[model samples]
Target: MRSMEVDMIRTLETDKAPKPLSAYAQGIEIPPGHRVVHVSGQVGVTLDGQIPADPARQHELAWENALAVLAAAGMDHTHIVDAHCYITERSHLGIYRATRDRFLKGHRPAATLLIVAGLADERLVVEVDLVAAAGAAGPAT
Candidate 1:
């Protein structure tokens, strides 16, 4: 197996959405010799794998999951360079922004928000995909 080293990866969200499901940013900073982590779409679920019903709550869960993945790999929000968010309810954009602000604080990554028909899970109101880089300075713009 091949192993790699990383310096730092940060995760951030505005009041817009919850933290991402991975230790990736809504965007990333990368240095040379780095590997980018591509996280799959994550729904709002508890650590034990309990899914939430509320659209806003589900967003929170998805974000938390993303962060957990990043931390496990020695990364955080700051390392995220790109993000994809899927929302079932178009009106949830406001909630997303609020939550994002709460989580990201200031750092905003390059992101695309989509209003989808549905997600993998029905109760899941939102799902997020993230891109994180390790062994680099930061994400590439």
Candidate 2:
């Protein structure tokens, strides 16, 4: 079963708006013929399946987990078009922002941050999910 190839993707940037704070484009323009990949929410569990105690550590781990999902789909951070972040406490915003900025470096994709009452696990301080696009489609089932 041969797979279909996707078209190239373009990152949209304009000086009209403030540059993205991290390693994501302000917007990603998917060509007419492109497919989207949705990565599910990822928590901050470590390789040993243990959630960290510090909120900042958890935030970093969550981003790593989400990026791992994109990588599994043969996409890198540059392919990300959007990201959604969830945090249990408002006080963690500063930490979250700093951690995200470090992880993204320069790519700033469309992003949304939400303060929630709690997460699926009480030990989890942050969770992140992403949507990405690549230049190759998947094989048909």
Candidate 3:
């Protein structure tokens, strides 16, 4: 029997737009034979079970939580292809964008932002979910 090797993933960064903060790349490219990973919406609650009162802090925590989930799936920020962000208040958009830009750095993945009435927890001001893809060594199932 013969073995097969999977190609590595690639990232795309361009000078066309503002530079990313440093946490992520401007874009990511997943080859044809890759596996996709989906991370559920993550709230602002910390590992210690504490949710910050400030919206900005909440936004940061949410992104951190989402990143952690992606890491658990054997992927990183560079593998992210899309993200969805939810904010409880319109006033928090600026803070949310700043936090997101910082966390994502230069990774310009497909994204969506929505202002919702509330989250599963009333104290949570922000929630974020992500999708990532990585090369798979095995044949497509």
TM-scores of all models? 0.72, 0.77, 0.75
lDDT of 1 by residue, 1-141 (tens): 121223643333365656554333443345567778888887788978888667788888888788777776677776666777889898998887777666665646667888999988677888888886656544332
Count clashing residue pairs per candidate: 49, 9, 6
lDDT of 2: 0.78
Q: Select the stronger candidate by TM-score from 2 and 3.
A: 2
Which candidate wins on TM-score? 2
Which pairs of residues collide in model 3? 20-105, 24-107, 25-106, 25-107, 26-106, 26-108
TM-score of 3: 0.75
Off by over 4 Å in 3: 1-31, 137-141
Q: Could you give candidate 3's per-residue lDDT for residues 1-141 as a string of tens digits?
A: 221222465556667776655344455567787889899999988799998887787888889999998887777776678788899899987798789888877666767788999899888888899988876763233
Candidate 3's displacement at residue 133, Å, is 0.6
Model 1: how far is 62 from its true place, Å? 0.7
CA lDDT of each prediction against the hidden true structure: 0.70, 0.78, 0.77
lDDT of 3 at 40: 96
Worst 10 residues of 3 by lDDT: 1-10
C-alpha root-mean-square deviation, each candidate = 9.3, 6.5, 7.3
